[model samples]
Target: MHTEIQSMHLRASQKQLTLHTGVYYTGMDDEAHTFCTVSDSLQHSPSAIWAYLTPVLDRIKAEVSDVDTINFYSDGPATQYRQKGNFYLFNKEMADRNMKQATWNFHETSHGIGVPDGVGGSLKRTENMSVLHGKDITTATDFVKTVKTPDSKIRIFQVTEEDVKSKIIEKLKLQPIPGTMKIHQILSVKRGELWYRDLSYNSMEVHEHQGQHLKFFSFWKVIMLYSICSLH
Candidate 1:
């Protein structure tokens, strides 16, 4: 079906003769849009889960800032949990090891519950504004209507990695892939729909570290940055 839609009203500055187009899609993007087959950007995160959620820890530090002991794999209480001061960070790296599609996957600190038993929920919407890739958000917005997939009921993009990869390259105007990954925070969760697979991103950041220790440090870096940005 083809039809000519009415032109959108635009806002512009009159500093010069040429008028500026309104800032393209914003309100629509604030709504949830799927990025096809979702994947954790930190699939290869260091074996240490605490190391991964360091960003959220950093974010919540100001509000819950009273901790002398930060340990991964809690002792006496929980074994599969890690802590930064009093806050905790879950470990879900290997469980979802296809981070190539991830640009940001750091939104789990505030999103997680107490543990294996306490892992009641994972927020899929709390995002960091500064570090996120506006491109990813724009891509999501620009194609929200087109993101429908064969199975759109669950709200998936149906767009494959190849589809996004091409757009990314074109949109970013890159000469090469640069072979790097960015971090993001997750906001919502589907609860009980396969743990690791249920995780998503909220914010984003880029990394250029060696893979061996990348996940470990990246995990913490976001936690730290999370604290800084949350305050702003």
Candidate 2:
């Protein structure tokens, strides 16, 4: 499983607007199906991306019931899935679905390439051709209506501000894992425990859930102190 977040500018009534897109692809069984959503906002923050992603994942899960382990490949962008908050959400999803293990692999910066790029490019080119042919794609609804293909697996959604905001995961109280900023390859958190490897480390550190929970309490105390100071 791989996903990519992309943004495009759409023209409507001579006004320019932003549309955020999430593309998902699974290259199994020699057949690739693409799932996507388009939102009229540039705020493709972690929450927004999660909102668009969860449903697509659920659909995939239903279809591929025999698969026990799932691997996600994505580009490392801090504001998006390559962060702690998204990791928590991913863990919760795995637990809820009863998956054995989930691994997320981040492609090295500037070296990320694959099905996502092709999907995004194909959609954009199709939309651009419609525009060149005098098709009016001014609204999210308009874009969806105009960009349909007979054999396309793409499912486009028109998202709203409230829809995106509702998807924000509750902030975890855990402290940042040491050396996360230097992480370049893989981050795997299974069943509430965390394991990570950075470019400088030869081996991954496995942090137990109990120890991490203790650190969470300590981290919460500091946050409470800061909140109290701001209240003064």
Candidate 3:
């Protein structure tokens, strides 16, 4: 089930509060769908907000200092967080493509580094993240989609600990890493999640993102973390 959308809110009555706004899809169906946003005197998470704004804020903070709290407004209804000392906002796009791209403002700006170059009727573009294959793995939105569509598989599996030493290995045609038997125990599959969970309930590192609650591993990073985790 989808999370309920809540009303837009503004942080109230604060002096020297900073504001940062970010856009996120959260897999919500349409542009007209409510947008979720967040801000902090510090930073907080399910981290969906960091999808765009964190990097921008890092840059903005370098320049803007007087701001201590932020103000937030959304084009429509949303379930978001706004505290007395911070501000955030979300804009609803009238179109889909822009709405989609709006969500990746960070990944695009930082990693994509794309812009028009003045020339003789010409333009130029450049991108880094050379370690990446064809796309990004840092953004949860992008990384979560990777395992869903493997080169040889379509269905995403919620592999259990038992499947770690056998099922995933056999299916992927990989020999088990010598001591990685308990690897799966450290990783809760990504099925229907804000993100995956490690064996520890504290598996994911979202800090007090919710008042009472709340939740990637990479393939190589995945293998390494699990390998070390298994030694315990």
Candidate 4:
């Protein structure tokens, strides 16, 4: 999911809200589900991303109880999903949620256009049509209430600023993992392990790493290492 600024032409307020849209694809069911989280908070930090994603993940698990693995495809923005903070969350949260394994695959820069973008565009167009029909979507809450109906195709949820703040508090202490920018796939198969490589198919790089490298470092441990690296 990516953050998009969706402007609403309300008769009074006319504010812009952040729309985090994601399209979920299930191969077993052969169906796609589109979900969005509307928030007034413009920050696209790791906390905010997780805040937007939590409800969607919960819904997925609720609907598909047999799902043990998840695969995510998104653009690689360091400030968002491509950095160390997110990796920590990805490793910790999957285990917390009883998920067996997960993989995050990042599209190369400037080539991320796909179904998620279409979902966002479709939402913008829907909101635009609503505005044309004399509906006012002045705030993020209003956007969610106005857009999501019983028969709506896209399930919309609201993420308050407090939710993001709480997530920030929950994942407060984090250490930046080295070589995050060069990584394209992060795969977590065990509780405290994350396997990553520059390209998903680059088995040679994985082989050079001496097989199954990149063990998960706890926050305090990584912080100590970070301090050591800073001194040198």
Candidate number with greatest lDDT? 4
> Candidate 1, after superposition: displacement of residue 39 in Å?
7.2
Give a tens-digit lDDT track for model 1, residues 4-75.
233321325211111001011122244322122222221211122223333334433443344322212222
Please report, as a residue range, the 10-residue window in candidate 3 with the lowest summed lDDT: 116-125
List, residue by residue over 31-95, the lDDT tens digit for candidate 2: 66666666665566767776667667777777776666667767788877677666666666666
**TM-score of decoy 3:** 0.18
lDDT of each: 0.25, 0.60, 0.25, 0.77
Per-candidate count of clashing residue pairs (backbone under 3 Å): 28, 0, 12, 0
Q: Quantify how close model 4 is to the true structure by its C-alpha RMSD in Å.
A: 6.1
TM-score per candidate, in order?
A: 0.19, 0.69, 0.18, 0.80
Show model 4 residue runs off by greater than 4 Å: 1-14, 169-173, 201-220, 223-232
Q: lDDT per residue, candidate 3, 53-157, as tens digits? A: 334443433544432322222221112222101111122110211221111111111232121111101100111232133553333233224433344211112
lDDT of predicted model 3: 0.25
lDDT score of residue 192 within candidate 4: 55
